[model samples]
Target: MASCSNSNELLSELVCSVCLELFQDAATLECGHSFCKSCLDRKWDSEKNSICPKCRALISERKYMRNNVLSNMADRAREMQIKGETNEKTQIKPSDLSQRAEVGNTDHFCKEHSEKLKLFCKEDETPICYTCVDSLKHCGHNFIPLHDAVSIYKEKLTEAKFPLETHLNEIEELQEKQMQRISEVNDQTKAMELHIKSEFATLHAFLQNKEQQLIQKLREEKERTLKEMEENLRCIKEFSDTIQTQMHDIQSWLEQNDALHILQNITAIENLLTRSQKNFIKSSPKLVKHGITLGVYKGPLQYGIWKEMLSVINPGLTSITFDPNTAHPNLELCEDFTRVKNSGIYQRPLTDSPEQFSLCACVLGLEAFTTGRHYWEVEVGQNNSVWDVGVTQASSNRRGNIQISPKNGYWTVSLRQGILYTASDSACEALSAKPQKMGVYLDYEGGQVSFYDAGDMVHLYTFTCEFNEKLHPYFYPGLKGSAPLKLFHLCL
Candidate 1:
């Protein structure tokens, strides 16, 4: 009777003190206290420093969203309150409370046989009546007294939930880190793009200057060649006039005087014409064209720029190969171990190793990194309905069906049933878009790993983590579908 009264008394705590009724849109404060969202907002609006109603802790702001955990508790509280009110309206007396308390004592009795459920069947994981234990369902199954089972399972539950709070804190920290790294990567990529544009502008300016210099030098050489030809033309005109004058004089001597006069001047005229022919032959210039040939530089300008850009992009692509020792028996590697898919045949290889995955269709990269940045792309074709790609610690478990998450030595994003997911401890968060091919970027010293659309900078997810061991690029081929995941040797 005393316990029943105390149980009824504890129900009042869920009510908002200001409203003196159930909370509507419940939200919790940081100080482990909760109130109706409207009530808290009103309280802060009426006051200047907006402190907690129960405790004088300074409320950060008047605006707040509904607390999901508290809202769930509020729903249960409302149901309890309604049930209690219904009981009151039914005209229950004080003596009825005592009867209800007494009824709970026999609540464990089996309904069909009216026998006390004193034993627990381990096989069925259920409490059963002693007669039921002897019946067909539990004829020879392991049984424990109800009290013993309660004591045993309660301790196990407690032990299992012991790390729940710590794990929650860790998950919260990881989520925070994941968000921070995403923002950083976005910012870094934007800054890098701007830097690239600035650098190309500078190169373009330099090339333009070089082009003008080449044109100017070509023009000067052309003018020099033309000036020499112009001087030769002046000399040739003067020599031609003199030859004509000499011809006229010889003709006059032939007409006016006699054969003796013509004969005497013929030698001098012949000498003059011969000298003119020799000079013209010796100084004759041939026509030829000259200009800058830009075939090599012009053809490879884009390719040259890309090669120079690689230096700034840093460790863009290191060829990835499967570590054969770590491949699961059901998985097969092709394209020089740069492509992986599941094989229907599950026979273990003759040269067996413990690094092989026993359950998952997984493979690891031959190259492991403890420091530096790396970028790689995977051609995740539309062949599989599910796939996981990311990096994992060298010492990660390969023998069991473990949760592949950051805390469990994996930092991966997954595609399952057309939804993209970034792994966390409890559940994966869905991404906005799905990608066919994915790009992975890792900065070991910065403790960052990021995923993006291989075709564009559409970031999917990122994880920030400090490593204590070497990490290898990890791949999970869809076991049932067996779609190939191909590694790209070139940066996108």
Candidate 2:
């Protein structure tokens, strides 16, 4: 019985009465008994009671606080065993200990100054040591405690990492999508390149054809102009020879007036001179005429006809009628077909139409000129309402008159007191009253009439009028008369 009793005590001491283990996660119960926390939890769960398993003492869950003191004592004992300093006295409770074992020892040193970095330089945005801070270079710079800087950096690091993390994830997803988009774009570009090449080829071919046609047309026009110029030169030379021969004959007859046949020869010479003059006048080259047929281009020789074809090309030729009573006296028509007026002088109203006028000029007899196509341009306007002027023949006039029109604005280029046919086939109508300064520009050369805005400054229109008449008036009255009527000359 004594052996059995000794064996029971040994067993009781070996195993924890509460845990029934070799004392792991050891904790002391309020009843002065010790147990493993897991084992006690297991016991409580199984029995639905908070009583100490070994003593059967009634205890509340509140009494089950972790036994940190015992846990520290156990930790110290384990650590001492690891260090080969095992001792029973080292197993002291955490509550009785004043120090803890060092944990996870690591080293950090400053790269510069070779000393520990203890502060952060706010200006340089770097960590520094006492030596660096006290240096002359850093004397005036701001600094913060390393610990404080670290805390701030930690917060910043968290913030910075959030965006970086999000961007990294987005980059991964976008890389795949980007590859797809690149492939699509490449395919579209290839198709577009091929299409552009095809269009270029077509355009090149079309341009080549147009170039050929233009060359041919230019050659024809050149030949026509050259031929007309040659004829004119020949006519001029023949007239000069005839005049020289007549003058020589007259001189010879005057010297031989004493001859008996002089009387008969003189009469015959007079008759011959009259006949020669008549022939010269009759044989003079007729004024060459030209006209335009406005048409839209469809293909070569194929054109779309706009019923009311408006000429927007060049329309600077104008005709104006002046009333001597209202016209400025200083304005005079020059022999060379230009109106000479005082620079700043304002002439009377060329037309009675509200005393307001805008210049519109036209070639009256384009067919009389050898030139096939006539072109002219004008510049008008002072302020915002200004527009570049242009003129071109809208159509050919078979009635010995050229139809001229304006391109920029509405202008009247009509004959003063003269009759004008409505169209090529229309009958002529007389201008009983003075029409709006129709179809004529101010004759700056004649000094007769001047054009102006409400401000009354010279606003001249430039133009070219081609006709057999060398002395062509820049301004022609909208009406025609049996007697010669005075007109203004275009300056340009």
Candidate 3:
């Protein structure tokens, strides 16, 4: 009875505190506490931080070992308890003690047949005794030794984990690259901002220098005109003095008492009068003040400056011309290739090539751009009610009727029936004024295609895309009008 009491006390110590039951699949923590593997996992999962269940010590790392010794002892303790409850005897026999000792030697036994589990059912994936092989539940199931099954499954698990590890490594590498790219973008933005500021500063300095030059020129002109007027004033003073001297001489002669002296001086006076009249007519010319004007500076000051700014601009405009090789059959290209007009009739016996457009009345530019900024203007006459202007990828279809949109590698805006619309599924907003001349600006690296009114400098529309190939300037001059589409160099 004392031994039995001692066994009961040991069993209580093996029980799990969380589930209040015998520990199944016992696991031991670093803090020397033990619990069922599942119970401890549940406790840790519900908490933000893992800790020992008994002592509540912080578990920095969730590393635990399976308590194999504790697991065996628990199994024996359970069996012993079950046997003791079924057979109540006050005194313990030697055979009973021997049997109790034998129970601790093996790990698991069949619940129904009380035989050691030695075989694993491959189909059922459960440990079973030899007696269970012929049982109805597992009669036809495939079986292997428990030890061999464990080894095989461990190898399979390791094999499966290799691809997962490789995938994880690849994902981590890509994540690092993405982070580096983000940093590079920020750095580039800062550098670009500084460059913009520096460019504007240069422009400001140029304008300031021009203003000083104009002011200096105006000052010099004023000084020259004033000096000429001063010379004219000196001439007038000299002439006045001569006239006063003549009048005085004549007055003195008139006061002479002798009639003979007066008569003799009359001839001299007449000669002097003739000479004075001739000198008066020739000398002392009247100074008519001419109105001063600022010349071209006074007319279209901003426009003049803007035009002059073209010289300083890094890239003023792209001179684009038509590519006759890509022109449609109904299109007529000028000798210079800068102009295209629809002939209203298809030209026959034309040399056909893969680059030629067979359906749409379209013509591509002679130059193709793959990088940097480019801007060009096309003059679509106001009388032409239908026209199209923009850019298209070099690989875009030229054989059939193509829908002009970004999806089709064509970024364009078209006018139909006197109304303008973007070359997409939707219509663009009404412009303030119709654009007779359309400007196309392409920022290849920036992935932007912008349209503007070349006449008024108004923004028409913009298309954003990721360009991966060569892009060409696109033009479509409808057959309804006799107006020819002409390309011109423009300043930004």
- Which candidate should be chosen as best, given TM-score against the real structure? 3
Specify the poorest-scoring 10-residue window by lDDT in model 2: 295-304
Where in model 1 is the C-alpha error above 4 Å? 1-318, 350-352, 425-433, 489-492
Off by over 4 Å in 3: 1-201, 206-318, 348-352, 489-492
| 1-492 per-residue lDDT for model 1 (tens digits) | 665545444444455556655567787777667788889978888898877675456767654556776666657767765677435433223233333333344345554334456777777766677567646667779987766765554344344333433433443454454444444444544443343344345456545554455345444644554454444444444444444454454344334332222222444544544543453355432222212121211122222344445543343455678888888888877758888888867645734455788777788888888987676778888667788889999888888676788888999988778778777733344545567787777768767787766655455666777887899999987865566888854322
Residue range 1-492, candidate 3, lDDT tens digits: 666556544554577767767779999999778889999999999999998766566887888899999899878767776677524433233233323333333335554444567888878766778778877788689988876765554444344334434533444454454444444444544443343344345466668676656555544655565555555555555555555555555455545544323332444655655644554356433442422222211222233356567676544444668898888888988778888999967753345576888888898998888897666778998888888998999999887787888888899999887678888846766876668888777778767787777775556677778899999889899874569999965433
Q: Which candidate number has the best lDDT?
A: 3
**lDDT of the candidates, in the order given:** 0.60, 0.37, 0.66
Clashes of 1: 0
Clash count, candidate 2: 50
lDDT for model 1: 0.60
How many pairs collide in each candidate, listed in order? 0, 50, 0
TM-score of each: 0.38, 0.22, 0.40
Question: How many backbone clashes are present in model 3?
Answer: 0
What are the per-residue Cα lDDT tens digits for candidate 2 across 223-308? 56445544554554455455445545545554552332333243465464564455435654332222110110111110001111
